[model samples]
Target: MQRIHWFSTLLLGFAAASSAQQAAQPAPAEAAPLSAPVGTDPVVTQPAAAVEAVTNVVDRAADAAEPAAPAEAAEAPGQAPVQAVVPGTPAAATAAVAGSTAPREGKIPALDSRLFPRYDSLQPKVAFWTKVFGQYSENQSAIHSSTYPNKVFEVLDFRADAMRLDKLALARLKNDEETRAKARYNRLLEEVDRLRDSPQQLNEEQRRVWQLYADVPGERRFRDAVGTLRAQRGLKERTALALETSGKYMPAMESIFRSYGLPVQLTRLPLVESSFNVEAYSKVGAAGLWQFMPSSAKIYMRLNEVVDDRRDPWTSTDAAARHLRDDYNALGAWPLALTAYNHGRGGIARGLQKVNGNTLPDLIARYDAKSFGFASQNFYAEFLAASDVEREWKTHFGEQLQRNAPLRYDTVETKHYVPYETLRRLCDADDEVFRKLNPAYRPEVIEGKLYVPPGHVIRIPAGHASAFNVGYAKLGSSERFDSQRSFFLLHKVAKGESLGKIAKQYGTSVASIKSASGLKNDSVRIGQLLKVPPREERRPGPVIVAVGESKPSLTRAETAAVEAERREQARPAARSKPKAPRTHKVRSGQTLSSIAKQYKVSVNSLRDANGIDGSHLAVGQKLRIPAS
Candidate 1:
C-alpha cells in the first residue's frame, strides 16, 4: 500500500497520532556529532526517492495535547525508518511530488484572515508551525523550546545522509539522536554560561539562541528554554500530501460546512485533524475524519460493535459540522471554538472563566488548566498553519503536488439487513473499494458474519448504483435478514471456565480474547467479566517529542461529555441508600421508555438519575439505575 500521508495530517494539534509516519524515523547514528558552537544543523534534505513520506503515524486529534510529562509518546509500530528533514535549508531541488515543474500561476485560496488573524503575540508560534508544515520534511526534527515553540535552537537531520533505513539502522539512528540531543542540551546550557557575562563574545549559534529569546529580558529565560527544549518532526511531506488528498473530499466538506452556514474554509481542518486520514484511529479510541472519541461520537454518529460512523467520511463530516457549529455557538469565538474541538469545550469554558477572557490569545497565553497542555495551546496555530499550507501548497511543493480528483459516489439506503458480500457482488464492487467508501462498517459486517443494518446508508461506486438497486430489489426473505447475527458482547466466567473454553464458545481465538480486555493470563474466576477482542493494527512506533510546552495526550477525553450529566449522576440519593442499584447493558431495539417502564420508573427520572441526556443507546452500553 502507498501508505497515504494525508490521513495522518488532517488530525490537527495531535502531533499526528492519527495515520502519520514516524517522525522521519531518525537514522541518527549515521551522522557525526555536532562540533563546537553547535545549536543546529541546516543541511539540505527532503529527497523524495529517499523519504518514506507516507508511512502511517497516528493523529490524536480528538486526543487533546495533554501536558507533556518528562517522557514523550512513541510512534505507531511496523514502519521502516526514514531520515528526519533538517531545517534552515531547502530539500534536494527535485519536486516534492510528481507534478509539473512549473508553479501553478493562480490566486491562492484566500482564508478570511479576520476570522483567524495572526496575533502579534502568536505570530512566532504560527511561523514556527509554517516551517513545520511547509519548510521541514518528515525526516527533519527542529529542536526548540516547548514553552517558546518558535525558539527553534537545533535542526536534527536523522537522515544522516541516508534515504531509507532497516530496523537495525533505525535503532542505531534513534540511539545516536538521543545521545546527540542530550549532549547538545547540556552544551547549550554550558555555552550560554560561557557567554553569560561576555555579551560581546558570542558564536553564530550562541548569538542565535540569545536572539531567539530577545522577547524576554536577561539570559534566564534562555536557560529555561534550553531546559524545555524538545524536537518536533516537520509535517511538510505529510501536509503537502494531505493537501493533494484533500481534493478527494474537500468539495463535499466545504459544501457541508456551507450548508451549516459556516465558513467554507473551515473544511480545511482535516489537514490538522488526521492530516485528513479518514481511517486514522488513535491509541485512544478516537476515530474517523473528525477524530471523535467513542464516548463523544456515540452521540452524533452510530458507534458500536457493528458500525463506527467516525470512520465514514460522509457521516463523520456531517457530525463534525454539527459539532463545530455547536462549539462555535458555545464559545462565541472561532479561535476558542476550534481549540475547544480538541480541548474539551468544558475545559475551554473553564479556562475562560478562570482568565475571565474569551479570546484565543487569552486562552493560549493564560489558560493553565491541567489538561490545557501543548495541543490545546497550539491548536489554533496549527489550524492556521495547516490552512495556510493547504491554501498555498503549490508555493511549498510546486509541481510535486498532484491532487486527486473529487470523490464521486452515489449513496443508497439498505432496505434490510443485507449481507455485505451479497450487495458487494451485486454492485460488482471490489471488496477493498467497498470497504474504503463504507469505512464505518465494523469488521464483522465486512466479513459477512453480520449484515448491514436496516436503513443504513451505503455509498455506491460511481457506476454501480443501478446494479446495487437491482440486486437489492430482488432480495428475498432468506437473502435479507432483519437482525444482526448474534454477537458475544460480554462473557461471564463460570466455575472452571477458562479462556480456551470461552474462546471456543465465541468462535474466537484465546489470544484475541486476551487482547481485547488486556488480559495477562488465562486464570478465570467465577463472575469474571470479559468481552471479545479488538484488533491491534497500530503498535507504538519510534518515539518523537513534538511541539507544545504541555504534553500531547495519548488518551481520548469526553470533550463532549457534558459536566451537567456528571453532576446529575454524582448527586447522591437524598436518603442514605441501603443497597447499590443494579446496572443494565442496553440492547438493540430497546429505549429508555421501555427500560424505565420495565424498571417501573419514569423516563424523566431515569434521565435525572443517570447522566444520560438522549434517548439513544448502543448495545453493551451500561446504564446505572437509581436506588428507590
Candidate 2:
C-alpha cells in the first residue's frame, strides 16, 4: 500500500503539473484559480520544489473531487468570465505556492495568535492567569515600599534586613557623635561657670560685687564672699602704698563721715576712686583722689586756683559723705544712694520708675543706665562686694595686714598771706609733710586771711612752734621787705634796649632778666614783660677796691664783670678766711661815724670798734673793729 500510494502520488503530481502548465499558457478565460476561501485553514507555503509538487498533487486531487464547470464558448471581444477552484484545492494550491509568500521587500512577521490574539479571540483562562501573577507582584512590591516601590511590607522588610547587616557599627557611630557633642557642651558650660563665679578675675572693686551677686546661688554665697575677702586682702600692699602717699588726711575723712552718721568705712572710698592719688585726673577731667568732675567739685567741694579741696582727701571725703548722707535721706536706701552718686539722683529716680516699680534688679534690667559705661549697672554691687571683702579680710587677718597709720597734726589760723616757702622754712617741715597736713591748700600758700579750713591741721615739728609763730608774726608785720619784690614788676623793653640796659634800669643783671623771663635767644619783643631786680643799694657797688683806697673809674662792662665776680665770691668759700682785728678811737667833736669813715669802716664795725652801741657813742673811747 505504501508503494502504490507513492506511485499514485507521483502520477497525480505529474498530472496536476500538466494542468497548471496548460492553464498558464493562455488558458480559456474561465479556467483561472479562485481566491482562497475565508474561514478555511490557511496554509504556509514553502519554496522547495518537492514540497510544491506534493502540495500541487494534493490540490489536484481535491480539484478532481469537485465538479468541473462546462467550457464557455468564445465571448464577445470585451467580455471576461470568472473561473472557480474547489474549496480544498485553493488551500492546497496556496500550500504549494512559491519559495516564500512573504513579501520579498516589505512584510511584518506574523504574531502568534495563540499567545496574544485579537480581542474577540482571546482565551479567558490565559488572561485570568496573567492578572493573578500581576497582582502577586504588586503585593510583593508594596511589602518592600521602604526600599522598593508598590508593596506594603517590602519596605519594612528591606529596612530590617539592612539594619541587621551593620546594627552595631551604626549604634557606635551615633554614640560617639553624642559623646562628642556632650563634651563640647560641658566645656562651654565650664567656661561660663568660671566667668560667672570667679571673683579673683575682677581687678576693680566695682566689678567684684556685680560678679558676686550675678545669679550666684544662696548656698554658695558664703564661699564666694570668703573668696572675695582673701582676694581683697591680697591687694593690701598695693592699697597701703597708694593710701600712704595720698590718704594722709583719712583721719579727718573719718571724722567727717562720723559727723554725718555715715559709715566710717567710706574713708577707704578713695581706694576705688583714684587708688588714693591726689592728682589723679580722669579722661573726662574729673580730678583728685575723690575723682570729682569739675562741675560737681565746684558745687560740693571747694575749687579755685588757690585751692582745690577736691584734691584734699579729708575735705572731699567730708563733701562726699555729706552728699551721700543727703542722698540716703532722700532715697532711704544705701544702694540707691550710691547709684545716685554715679548717675545723679534724678537719673536713678527715673531709672527706678522705669522698672514698673522701684526695684533695683528690675531697674538694672530695664533702664538704660549709662553712667559708668555698660559695666556701670553693676557699680554699686562692686562697691558692696569690695566692702564685704575688706571687712572679712580685716577681721580674719587682723594686724597681719599693715594697718594705715593715723595722721597727726595741729591747726593754726592766720589772717594774713603767708608764703608756702616761709611756712615750710619756719616750721622746719618737709614739703611732703606739710602738704600731708595741709592738703586743702592747693598751692600750699594761704592767701589773705584763709581760715585754714577744717581739714588743714598744720603739722608743727618738735620745738618749731615758737619759730613758726615768730615767722608768722613777721608775715603780718608790714616792715618786712620782699627780696623778690623788685623781680615781681613787669617791664617792657624798648626797641633799642638790650637786656643789659633793661636789667641796669631795674638794678638787675642781663642774665637774671633773661632767666626770669625765660628768653632763650636773648631776643625781647618791644612789649614783652620782663622781670628785674629792685633798686636796693646796687649790691653795694661791688666793694670797689678797699674802703681806704680811691675808687677807680670803670667801663660799664668792667664794672658789671667786677660786680658779677664779687657776687660770685661773696658766697661763703668751702674753707673759712682768717679774720684781722684793728683798733679805732672816737675823736673830740668827731663822730664815731667820721672816725669809722676815715678808716672805711662799717657802722657795725664801729659798734665793735669802740664797744659802743650804734645807737649811742662816747667821745674819746677806744674800740676794736674787724677789718675786711
Candidate 3:
C-alpha cells in the first residue's frame, strides 16, 4: 500500500509526469526540477544518504538473484544458488542481468533535492506569505491567545520592481541604521492599527455596497483583508515566538525525524500546526503541537480517561514522524504528503486522479474538489512560510529575542497505581512542577480522584533519578494510596436479607463481601452495613428464591394476571392509609435509607417527593415526605 515515489518515476517516467500535467493547469511558477543533484546543503545531503543506502541494498539484491530451473532436472543435495559477487561491479549491470533472468525490481528512487527547493522565487514566496498571513489572521479574529504578538511591523523590500527580502539573512546595519529602523517600525505599527480601525466607521455608500455581498456564505470580504494586513504587520513578532519555541523541541524532534529516515525540515511543521504550543486545542478536538485528532491519535498514541499521550510532546513527535513517513511512502511527494497531513491521503489521491496531475504544484493550482477548502489548499504554503520564518528568525529579530531552553526530563516506569500526593512527595516536586512534567495525567487524576495508572512512564525532572528510585523503593508496593482500586459501595442489610441473597443480588461472591467487610462468618443482622462489589461483575448463578420454592416459569397471560392482582392489592392498601406530614427534618449522618425506614416507605418514593436523586443528605434540611 505504501508505494515509493521513485518506482512510479523509474517505470512510468514522462508518462506519469505528463499525465499529472494534463489533469491540472500548470502552476503559476515554474515547476521545481524532478531530479536535481544533491548539492552541499546538509539538509539535502542528509536525506540523500538514506536514499542511497536503500538503493545499494536494492542493487545487491538484484546482483544476488538467480534463475529457478526445472525442479526435476536441477535436483541436487543441499546445493545453494550461485551468489553474485564482483569487485567494483556497477549496479546497472547487476540490474540488467537480473532483469533478463528474473522479474525487474528495485528500490523506488528517493525524493530528489529538486522537489524541496528553498523558495528563493518571488511568485512562490508571495504565495507562502499570503497563506501564512491568512491563517494567522483567521486565528487572531477568533477568541484565543496567539503566539504572535498583535503589535509588530513587517518590513518588505521592493527593489528591482519585485518584492523580495532574505528573511533568513540578517541585515547588516550601522548603529544609526538600527535606530532608524526601530523608529520606522513603530510608525508602521501605528499606521496599520489606524487603518484597521477606520473601516469600522464605514460611509453610507460603502456600507450599502458591502451589505449587498454580506449574505454570501463563507465570505467576510473586507474584514478578511484587514485581518491579512494585521497578520503581515505582526509577522516578525509571531516568527520570533515560533523560533523561540522551536529551540526547546527542535533538537529532539529532528532526531526523531532522522530516525525514521525523513527530512529534518519536517520538524518545523508544528509551527504551522500549533505554533509549537503543547496545550493547543482545535475546535474539532485535535490537540497538542501536532494537532492530532482523537481518532488518528488512538491508532498511534495511548488516549483514555487515565492518560492522553497526545499532550506529551516527546511521545507525540515519534508518532507524528512515523505517520509522515507512511504518508510520504504512499504519495511519493513531500507536497502531496504534507497536504495529506491537513486534509487526508484518500482525498488527496482522489483529487490527483480527478485532475490527472502528478505534480504537487499542478495539483495545488488545478485541483478543485469541493472538499479541498481554503485550509487544505494552503496548508503546504503555510508550512513553507513557517519554515522560512523559523529559519530566518535570527536574521529578523537579531539578539533581542531569547531562545527557550531545551526541555530535559528523566523517565520512570511506575510499578503500581500511585496517588498524586505520594508521587509528588517521592519526586520532591510541587504541584505546578509535577503537573508540568506530567501533562498526560488528566485533571481528576492529579486531583486524586483517580490514581496514576500502573506502568505509566512518568517524566521526572532531570538529575533526580536517584532520588526518585530511592523514594519509590521506600514507598514499597502498597494499595493504600489507591482508595477506589476495587470500587466498593456500602450496602445496608435489610431485616429478611441474608449474606448469600445479597451476594447473588449484587453479583459478587459471598467471600468477597466477607473479606471486604472483615466478617468472621455468614451472620448478618438488620441495619448492619457491609461493603459490596460493583453489580456488573456479579456472578451468574441460581438466586435464593424462598424457603422451599423453586423458580417459576410463567406464560404471558399468567404474568399479566399476577401483575394485575399485585397492583389491585397495593391500590387498596394505599387508599386505606392517611397522608403523612408534608415535610420531614433531616438528622446527622441519617441517609435516605434511615428516613425511609422511619416512615415505612421506599427510598425512591421519598426521593421523588423531595426532588432529589442522590443518597447524600445534610442535617437540619427540610424534605417533602410523601404519604404511604
Predicted structure 1: lDDT = 0.58
TM-score of each: 0.64, 0.37, 0.46
Write the residue-wise lDDT of candidate 2 on 1-628 in tens digits: 0011122222222243343333123212222121121222221111122110011011111111111111221111110111111111332222222211111111212222232122211122112111112122111111111100111111101223334547566445434433443343234334444555564664443232333234335544423332111000013333434423332344345445555666655555565555566666655555676666665554454464346667665556655775676666666666566656655666666667766755455566577544323223433543433333333333323334432333333333333334556566667777666665456675424432222321122444333455666676665444222111112457877789888778766545675555445567677778777765323221111111111112212223334445666777797767767766667666668765566677776544444323332345567666666574
Per-residue C-alpha lDDT of model 1 across residues 1-628, encoded as one tens digit per residue: 0112222322232332221222212223322211112112211112233222122222233335421111223233221111121111112111111121111212334456677666666665776677788888666666666676765556666554345777577657655774577467657666876687786888765665555555566657656655566667778877766665555555456555655788866777777777766666666656666677755564455565667678877667766776777778777878877888887777788888999886888877787776676667887888777766655555677754665544445455555567888877776767777776667777887877677755455565555566677777777887785344434467889888889998876546686566555577887789988866322222221111111101111211111122344665799858754686778788989998788878876554455445444567889888767554
Model 3 earns a TM-score of: 0.46
lDDT agreement of model 3 with the native: 0.49
RMSD of each: 17.3, 60.1, 24.0
Q: Any idea how many clashes model 1 has? A: 46
Per-model CA lDDT versus the true structure: 0.58, 0.40, 0.49
Task: Sort all candidates by lDDT, best to worst.
Answer: 1, 3, 2
In model 3, the runs with Cα more than 4 Å from the true position are 1-122, 125-235, 476-628
Q: In model 1, what lDDT does residue 392 have?
A: 54
